[model samples]
Target: MSSMKKRMIKGMVRWSVLPADCILNSCIINIYKEGDYIPPHIDHHDFVRPFCIFMSKGNIIFGKEIYFVGLSEFRGSVTIPLPVGSVLILKGNGADLAKHYIPRVPWHKVLVTLRRMDHSKIPYGFQSDLELEELRLYEL
Candidate 1:
């Protein structure tokens, strides 16, 4: 697909080594300011197995393998403080089992995410189910 190829090229331009024909669903850009955070949760399975997540602006404290139990939660063994312009690719059960989240930041930050899709995994004739696609119609 042209869109998938375009997304792959975009990632390559950002210095990614992924194949140029990698089937990517789309690119998501998030801009978070002070006091903003990404709530702890596992990435959805709509996309493919590997998720390419990166940051382009400021630094962030990245938590991995988070375990939650009702009103309480526990941090796993890995706690990485990511630097600017860092790219992380997660595959297999990395996302399926472990949860990752970015805590509230004291400064502004920007994140670019590339999500791939397995055409076979996607439900057929469900394009209308995509809110983003509907929004794209108005160029919103």
Candidate 2:
């Protein structure tokens, strides 16, 4: 594994948000600019719950039914601010039942998401990284 990825994993482990046995093998980096937004939707079942590390200030909306308020605005039952350096672990009803999305960002924002791939969803010919096979969080 790349040293950078190893460091990121270690940092996430230190947060103790995910289970000690959870093995995260994939990541998604999101970069949003002013007026950029993600529409509300539930996560696909292709992967386990995701852990998101926020790198900038923003708000994420979550609700059973998200309503559109304007071209770059939305309203949900709950709005959570994602402060810089905050880690959010999604699971249970928060992950399965509630739909979530980011409204248009006011400025530049970034997020790093980590997740474990479901065995059935592993792409053909993709090999698991041996180094990550036994990865576990350290006791915090």
Candidate 3:
């Protein structure tokens, strides 16, 4: 609908696995300081399409399993070392069936997240100039 939306959608279609018709109505930028952690949970929002997490700095360990005693035990859970400029896309089986979280970051971290929103969930007064052309320069 908006110029930014059009650009992002076009970029995703060309550069990512996002469907050609996928429509992302919103984007989120998150910053996490050292010692920060997000509890594991399912992102079952209907408006949200497959989410993408792009790391700008620091390292993180994703996917912590929940223990019976009401705690996170990342014993054998896969640990992904996200160096700066790493992008992790969440989709398909892993996105729908499992919960994932980032444990405390050893250093500051920044995340650029894009979420495709259904019409009803689009945030009001949101606008951006997403440079679709830049997608061509990015190494997928």
Which model scores highest in TM-score? Answer: 2
What is the C-alpha lDDT profile of model 2 across 42-74, one tens digit per residue?
Answer: 888787875444557778889999898988677
**Which candidate's lDDT is highest?**
2
Off by over 4 Å in 2: none
TM-score of each: 0.63, 0.86, 0.66
Evaluate candidate 1 by giving its C-alpha RMSD to the native, one decimal. 8.5
User: What's the lDDT for all of these models?
Assistant: 0.60, 0.76, 0.60
lDDT of 1 by residue, 1-140 (tens): 25544544454534445543453566688898877777677777777756777875443333454555434234554666676767777676666776777666678888878776666676666452232232211112
- Judged by lDDT against the true structure, how good is candidate 2? 0.76
Record all residue pairs in model 3 with backbone atoms less than 3 Å apart, i.e. clashing. none
Report the number of backbone clashes for model 2. Answer: 0
Query: Which residue pairs in candidate 2 collide?
Result: none
Roughly what TM-score does model 3 have, to 2 decimal places?
Answer: 0.66
**Candidate order, lDDT descending:** 2, 1, 3
Better-scoring candidate (lDDT), 1 or 2: 2
lDDT of 3 by residue, 76-136 (tens): 2566677676767677755776666666666777776676666566567765334542343
Ranking of all predicted structures according to TM-score, beginning with the best and ending with the worst: 2, 3, 1
Please state the error at residue 5 of candidate 3 in Å.
9.5
- Backbone clash total for model 1 is 0
